[model samples]
Target: MNDDLHLRIILISPPADVDFGLQSGSGNKYKTVQKQVSGNGDLLFVLSVKIKNDKDGNIDFAGPFVQGSKGERFIYIDIGTYAGNPESEWGRRLKIPLRDIPVSVIEKLQPDNKLILETRVPGMGKDGGPNCATVKPFEGWHAVPV
Candidate 1:
């Protein structure tokens, strides 16, 4: 069994031609490509992460992963300003914390298991301000067999 965690992070109907990526707590990053979504939109990314555990038995990862203190462990996602250029002044960074996740879901996490995280990027353009991009979980998080 592959102990590494498989993450399927999907962005539904993001702003056209914008860039997106996955960022770790160590500052490493992976840029996402615009892939065709079934609904005439784009899917941001589906990344694989190596699972690590802290001394306190909390879940952690090796690279480009961030887990908060005992109360707020999370995964970080970055939204770039443009499709090709990730360094735009208008880019945004979002987080998906592990809080509120059911214990049953965590218990189901085994080697090679896949976790699906779907979110929608809201208020991209328009009067939405510089920090306008707010990420909300679209369908919540799911853990499934690989």
Candidate 2:
């Protein structure tokens, strides 16, 4: 839980799995590459963390995101979808975009040593699936600078 990690938050377009087809059902086996991040659909913002040896550690899941005037703008994860399944690393990791994020919210966050999207024990990801992310933004995720 070191709080000095650097993360990069980027607004990304949820790419379609050219290999699995955009509508691939319960299973998304194809891996994604940076050059392949194109196409359209819901926006997904991801926290790109630098892990050991400078390898990029990806923090997916449409959990807590760019906060808004009303509250923290969190995204929803379709249960059992490609997002919920971490295997879809190359594509849709279920993250929310930052364009919709406000400047005020971004100012309140700090980075951590590593990437670990936090999940509460009594919450969805912990007990059941990432059920609608019903509990809203998973609480303990540290991100990189905006």
Candidate 3:
């Protein structure tokens, strides 16, 4: 392949309540993972899903490939963290780099599709506690509000 593909996978858009004004990667958390697919069917996984902030978090990923028998294919990404609330700022925005994802996976995600976003907060059950938020992005990415 002469050129590489790039995509901004969006997990969530920021709510109106956030004060995410003029910040770097100001909208959504994203990880820039990439794969270079050769015409001969070679694939390379470049990176893993990462958080947008300084905190430590982790995620998992599976193929940007085709399922031959069933004719079903998709990229699998799972992210979970104690998504802290956005008081002065937001925390733990996650991202999936489009270039890292195969076009096969991108085809599966369309607008208005309801997908599950797994989450846990340090104190979601209590009052005066921090809440979590959404993540998305492009190249030169940063974890920002969705």
Candidate 4:
């Protein structure tokens, strides 16, 4: 992977059943325009995510949160979501808002050049499937080249 390429992932929560009434297509499609990052070489990959609640409920969009190393490791920008109910298993799902996640390779990795990005619902099973036994604050992991 080229160090100059930037990777970004953003999660968006659509209105309940409203679908924004846009084109009917993939469930994980993004409606926003592609964004570019300057002074970084070039934008290589961009991923837009749509997180939906299995049950009828509301998800809040808080903003963007940063995860992983500050300079060396890849950065995860969370769009933010409303806090789910602590008592209800189905209601505890975190909602990520719609936006562009910006990723840039500012430095070089120590040993490896390839990075892997992974995401999962915290306290859930290997698959992201919903289950009452699972807990909230789903966990997501992202690995990127330095």
Candidate 5:
């Protein structure tokens, strides 16, 4: 395994919007959803990264590995922190700061090897109002030819 293989984990933050839902009455009355906003909140996201083995021979990919029912394959990653916004709105869109993630591989893979990555962000709520939304990376992983 090389030093680059050790750098295979990355954390990134994307853009997000505030979602507002209105409660309507039968007599043309409506209610607005009230929620508390703060600037000291953090956004977290999880990523799943998989390195596929296609070519012949032995290859060691440097990254976290989770055991599965089928076999000892690679998939999904657990990233602790990322980037997010701190704007408050009833229902609006806002651009927030994002985090940077970098991944390195120590070992080399065979030919036709593929890598897949997925990102997931948990939802948060405040003051019994709607949960805060978060934006994450579109794709989690990348593939490299060894």
Candidate 6:
């Protein structure tokens, strides 16, 4: 495995003003992106390698992250549904763990590469399932040519 492999998680136009962050393996928290918003009216979360999965595949990530604890890796997506509505009240700030993403999808990523993602929040679909945020590599999603 390459030591510099990284994946960028970009949310394409979320439905609400949401905040995102990261919790490291040491139980330290860091505010990554405030009110996830891309210039094109979307949210972007760049994936960085915090710790390499050992033989145990213990994920040292927590708090709104998608990482695998097993041998496989994952991408975590956490969204804050501060819409102040009933449906949005219960599942507010859902911790979505994308455990099914194939490692090959991002295994070849280099420092300059990016993995564009598309998701359906508060709905059931690809990447994640019902009543949770879903994220999947955009069809034909590949490492950006460097």
lDDT of each: 0.49, 0.29, 0.25, 0.26, 0.28, 0.39
Candidate 6 wrongly placed segments (more than 4 Å): 22-40, 50-66, 81-141
Greater lDDT among 2 and 5 belongs to 2
lDDT value, residue 117 of candidate 5: 30
lDDT of 4: 0.26
Per-residue lDDT value at 18 in model 1 = 47
Task: Please give the range of 10 consecutive residues that has the lowest summed lDDT in model 4.
Answer: 15-24
Best by TM-score: 1
lDDT of 1 by residue, 1-146 (tens): 22455566555555554455556443333443432312337455566555555677665544345445555556655555522353654456556554554546655765545444333443243443322333443355677544
List the lowest-lDDT window of 10 residues for candidate 3: 65-74
**Positional deviation of 24 in candidate 2, in angstroms?**
17
Off by over 4 Å in 1: 1-3, 26-40, 49-63, 81-89, 111-134, 137-139
Structural similarity to truth (TM-score) of each candidate: 0.57, 0.23, 0.21, 0.21, 0.21, 0.46
Candidate 6, residues 1-146: lDDT per residue as tens digits? Answer: 32434444445444443343332222234233333421335555555454344556532332234345553444444334332222332233333344444556555553444444233333223343222333332332345543
RMSD of each: 5.1, 14.3, 17.2, 16.3, 15.7, 6.8
lDDT of 5 by residue, 42-88 (tens): 33323222433335523323233222222333323211111112344
Question: Which scores higher on lDDT, 1 or 5?
Answer: 1
Model 4, span 1-146: residue lDDT tens: 22222233323221221111111122244222232211212222254222222233322112123112222222232111112122322331222222222233223322356553433322222343221222234343344642
What does the lDDT come to for candidate 2?
0.29
Q: In angstroms, give how far residue 37 of model 6 lies from its true place.
A: 5.9
- Which regions of candidate 5 deviate over 4 angstroms? 1-98, 105-114, 133-146
> Which residue pairs does candidate 2 place in steric collision?
5-112, 5-113, 7-144, 32-90, 45-96, 45-97
